[model samples]
Target chain A: MSADPQRGPLPAWSLPAGETDRIRIATQWPEEVTREWAWGGATGAGVRVCVLDSGVEADHPLVGGLAGAKVISLSPEGEVVVADDSEGDVVGHGTACAGIIRGLAPKVELWSVRVLGAGATGSGPVLMEGLRWAVDQGFDVVNMSLSTTKSQFAGVLHELADSAYFRRTLLVASAHNMPVESYPWRFSSVISVGSHEEEDPFTFYYNPEPPVEFFARGVNLDVAWRGGGRIRATGNSFATPHMAGICALVLSTHRELIPFQLKSVLYLTATNVGGDR
Target chain B: MSEPGRLQAAVAAGVVGSDEAYRALLQSIVEVARAIFGARASSIFLLDETTDELVFEAVAGEGADTLIGTRIPSSTGIAGWVLVTRQPLVLEDVTQDPRFARDVAERTGYVPQGLMSVPLLHEERALGVLNVLDRPQQARFTLEEMDLLGMFANQAAIALDLLQRARRARALVDHNASGDTAAVARLAETIETLEDERRAAGVRLVQALDDILRGA
Candidate 1:
């Protein structure tokens, strides 16, 4: 759920009656498909997925009933504390990804593992600590829509994800949106997801060698927000949710599929690169 | 299924060269034969035009070398029969058949009771034969079974022929790029090992025109 809130509430978002002063979040996903995925299968029901990102607007209408947070832990200095989100979701990137996951996997239980403190920056310790918490908490899927150039931090996330995969939890991380792939995404175990618009989903070949396992819609995407508002999103952060939601959808049907199997199925069922690639 | 599927996969993987693709292709072919038809053993032979003999490209089940470089006249043995007729040939018992040559049995340890061969022809030219040595659990190949085998042959032929042409083109380019006696020897040894996948693109031309060939 990596988005900048400035793009404004997503289109086609309607506020419910008597819900005055509520943030309005809209689906960038086409209504028909969203509605279909919602009604069709598990819709992420009963499955627990983790969203590790910036803080969520507790009062946001678009993410109503879904749960998330910054991992509360004792500081290295032995101080009891929670991640400082001086501006929780003030940018709306985390909110956008959360909305898409909900729209796609409405039935699944979700836990938000907030890591970014402000301006999409978080320490390696904070990010790794967040991942460990999500894994220990046993999430079916963990969507890390934010990553940094920190190689050591990236290694921690990848190793944890590799272990998590064996543990039946899928970990999806973002490739840096800066036009080239950097660490965390460069890590092997992580199912690195990249951003692509609906107009060019097939063209974004996740690096043939390393990182970039899959791609999803990210260009000009709308996400539901608080007070009946939504915002358009761009970049790999925005795209990771699509894969997370898809993981939820698949896990709902194939509860037995471990992370590797889940990754394999997605690669298999996805439009084959045979002729397309 | 995997041989063709994996070949298709490798082509898609853009993994040219290396024996790994060959191993993957062989495993795929065996799996396909067993799954699609209850075959006990199967082997794919490559025609070595320079030696005028068929060499084992892939083999599965018992007596694996039964199809490797087993040579005969162009119109003599069962393989030659396919080359001459450009059609599949079936033999219930090679001993009872008059067309069956006895001398070739010394090279290939296969004592045939039931044999089926589908000519791998692409663009109407014989590439090789796709053969199943024996049926599973005493079952024999039926006419209907052979037809399906024919269909498999048709797809394989087209894919293989395209594969070969691509190989030749690549060899020519490599030959010209590095000229020497050593280069020529290396080229011959490595061209088959250097497989460039042939892309299969669907027709976009149908949508280019307003007129429809078939009414909607």
Candidate 2:
């Protein structure tokens, strides 16, 4: 698995029988693996990160610009429809997440998939539909800053999360703002994030215990609001995009890395896990 | 008694001689917490709402007792972070983390490498923080352990709440009883002073009688 001749060609056949050849390549490039990512060099240049939240205003200055935007809404008769850029931000939550990602990774392709409505609440069916749309669109990283508390939709969300995982789309989900249970952030297939009070915008920590695997600077962060302005906000919702933006950076370089490999790289790059470099 | 029950008893027992039962209970909590988590030290703090300060109620560990009664602003230190945010934290390297204030540990003469702290919350309001410092063998805290400490923090919050209420109730009763005792002591002193005056009068009368009898 080593690219260097001294470490030699660690044979692909040496891996477990069912493992893919990419595993061998990943093993060869251990130097590329890290938990604490440096934001200075990595621009997340080509990676497509989809922000799934309360719609994004494509013209928001902090957002820079979006590569594409979609809005999922429930019709009067309860039909889920994924529409083009006809919709603007309902509550600015999605715009906030998009701005954070843009701050961290300046050149990444941004996609807005609006799931939450004006009240910052959305039905499970609409959430599922929007997530499905994002996954099917083949975005490299999907940032889900929202979650459904309803138990009825857990199975569907779980399935979609697994599908995204298998299809090499990294799902970064936010843990519930409160202590109460919510999904699909709880799903192991998704990277769960929580808020930390770190002052640095780019700094994040890897949680020793998970279900909430990461913590980013979500407390007192200035994020893009709806009216071409910024507002200081705090929540797990804001933290997910930080991870997603970081994921975009990781995926930009390690383009062939799958979900599992990406998670390993994140673990290795975490502030605590990788010796704080 | 259950833990809460015992904690209530310890507080209700009041001061034995010069030592405070509340202090004893707080120390017991720290000792039990340390033993349970295999931590090098443990400490309990109470939020003094009047002063907006976190008062170190009790401490158990090597030289940590010296930190008792230390007051920190409720918005300062790692303990303050837990109190303000109402979130538990487990840090693997206290020195490396910026949020971990070294000054608090310096004052206690114990610098912990790894620590876990949970807010002692009653209802939605945070009462204080319960800290387990320096996991001697482990580098970081596990979720199961953080959960366990959280549960323990809940119980401690309830216990501390009950103890404060009990103290207030006891203070009212003791205030009346002590007031009466002070009144009785004053009366006794007054009677003694009166008796001394009466004796002096008697002595004066005798002197007059003696002068009369002596035909001065």
Candidate 3:
């Protein structure tokens, strides 16, 4: 079970035993730029963002709206079934991601496209199919907070981004915060976002150059899970939405803007993270 | 010798007033048109605000005639329709469309089959029309083509507006002889903004346009 928010700042993810005293400073990323960078209602409300991860609970206050999710239920005779709302995040991890995206682009219509199973261990094909479907369905932005090792969908993803560019769409992927060799963050076609832990010691792990393009406040970040228990989250998964939100904001303001415009705006506005990479 | 954006800069810089500025501005426009489109014909028209008519102001085409004084009514022809609606007009068969007035055809003696006409609009106030005639018959105007014309037209409108303002300011500067301080200050402000925007956007435009050209 994750720590409760009522307990105030989970200790496990907190600075371990007073190591917070001499935490080395790095790039001067902004604090709470939801105002300066957001431009508020400039964009975000008009477009649809498909979050392909664990199923999101429809009833969650942060997770309101039908969003038209697809879920296949199975019968005893090895038959497929339909459970649209049931496809939502079964584990609390997916909920954490969904909330981050929701907080950022609140007005955006989100489709909780669930491709991962309970363990967050769905095969590569499942996620790729979701991405193709999202593009086909005319989503303006796609948020992928999941990744893999044996994924054959890398080339397909490049094609997907190019096609989205042709159709004027954006793909926002999380640069895995786990410090693992992963394809999700390393892909060039997608905007790779990493986490920057403000006042936390674990910040450097999130910095090195795998696919990290932009940085967002990520360490000990608060996210609500099932059963009213909340936990301070850690990982690049938590950071990706900030970049996605910024992209959605831009795409929304300048609808006629192509992908190049979208890319330029982000790079221009980004506060360069770390020093070396 | 000055390019379009740079000449606009010189005018803003007080090197010359509106008349000379517009004269050079229009020339550079047609020159760029000749360079990029490889078209033998190009022209610019100024809208008469009071009469709402298109009066041809400049021309650069093969055997391009002086329709300089001809005033085409806003409600009358193809170019007129383009000006009124602020929508681009393309004609693969010029004689086929009822909007094509045949006045330019009769005047220039060029029976052009393909034509592209873009509305010269400044903030929804249709200034006139920027037209290229005798375009190759097989050429179809794509969205990019339409937008490119619109972009060129946008720059032209800015230069033209500045040109007009500069001309009026020249008259004021001569007549008032430095007594009318307030109006002169406002004129200086407008000129500065235009020149500044052009100068700043020029640098960005070169980089971004190169990136776009290289297919990035």
Candidate 4:
């Protein structure tokens, strides 16, 4: 088949010079960012945190209630499945994530962009659309606990992830539990988290390796379920929300922190880094 | 039987008896490509000339059970891009590029972090796309891998063209040498049986590859 006569060759996918290693650390520790930095008067009051997953059960006591929630499912034909407000959680996954974020940053405005349902599986396009919707809504922090393994959609997801980053909307993604490669967690632009056995919910560690950059507590911990109850589950999925919660707290007080700056701040304040030793 | 040997067997069976054997041969090619790649999933789409769509004829990979009959617009997604451009692509980080279509991945269930795709061309005409999903971790796809996939796609395209021509030959035989209604009916039934075998074999190949790659 012949290529479109009008379309030219795409620009080479390259990074800016000196950005080959994106996550570099500052040699000297900032004295102002102490162990209590996350808890330093910022309750994430003005930041908006969007959970992109199965719809969250907003009425769950731990969640109190969502500031706003929307369902973004697509029909088998890729048509919009619903256009109005959300119907509620199909499973308890979103609720658990919401609970974690709410617990860490109590005053953050919570929103849900439901891209999955009872099957607990969603199409790549639907999830992409949900992420795009969250970004368009100008949410401060978008927590993506789920990811697509379809490589065909990678470029678009990367674009959206970068788009969110440039717009100052922090996208927090989880590394796959199966160890199989997936995205946008693999993208250096977004914050990627993995599960660690640390008991403290707020305790997170910066990885020395590339790809999976951070680890947070994702073991069996009590979290809100769909029926307003609690359940214990473990996966990198759970670890992601803890980081998102902390990010909301950080952004609330430091409104000027872009994704790069926020990540640096996180690296500096990590349990194993800087003065937290 | 060895993969190439199966193709020979299918071809022989198709030429001597009915058209079913040809389909088996085509499906085997798809399976062999999946195994060689150690892919999380793989699919073969045939281009629909009239509608400019790529219709899934065989899918072997994780969660691909329901994707056998799915159709994608020929102008959308990377498959379409590959078909139109007649170029092979190996994307280590698929999301970082702009050419990828997110909607197509959404339809497939899981978005692949890494992908390798090539167009199927025969006689300078684009036939469709052959794509493999995520590779084993720490193993990035290289130019050598892209060339290998392109080679596989070439062989598959030629084999498919042969299958179509064989089916046409059978129809001609029915019209001229074999006027027996019962024999013609039996030939049709045989072809149908062969299609089932082909589909089952393709799925089994993918499942086996998945088990092997996952170290299950």
Best by DockQ: 4
TM-score of each: 0.43, 0.52, 0.43, 0.53
Predicted model 3 interface RMSD = 28.7
lDDT of 4 by residue, A1-277 (tens): 3223589433336445555454464334356777566447788899999998767888989998988888876676757664655567654567888999999999999998877541212345677788889989889999988676567768999999999999999999987433234678989999999877768987899999978899988765667766666654455777899999999998897787789988988988888886364
lDDT of 1 at A54: 54
User: Which should have the higher lDDT, number 1 or number 3?
Assistant: 3
Q: Lowest-lDDT window of 10 residues in candidate 1 chain B? A: B198-207
Off by over 4 Å in 2: A1-27, A35-40, A118-122, B1-216
The CAPRI-style docking tier of model 1 reads: incorrect
Model 1 agreement with the true structure over A86-121: per-residue lDDT tens digits: 344432445666787887777777666655431112
Give the DockQ (2 decimals) of all models. 0.01, 0.01, 0.00, 0.02
Which tens-of-lDDT digit does each residue in B13-125 have in candidate 1?
23244344444565466558756766667766555555555555666776554554445433235554344323344444444432232444565655555556766655424
Q: What is the TM-score of chain A alone in each candidate?
A: 0.72, 0.86, 0.71, 0.85
Overall lDDT per candidate, in order of appearance: 0.56, 0.71, 0.57, 0.71
Candidate 2 chain B, run of 10 with poorest lDDT: B10-19
For candidate 3, give the lDDT of residue B216: 96
CA error at residue B49 for candidate 1, angstroms: 72
Clashes of 3: 6
List the candidate numbers ranked by TM-score, top first.
4, 2, 1, 3
DockQ of 1: 0.01
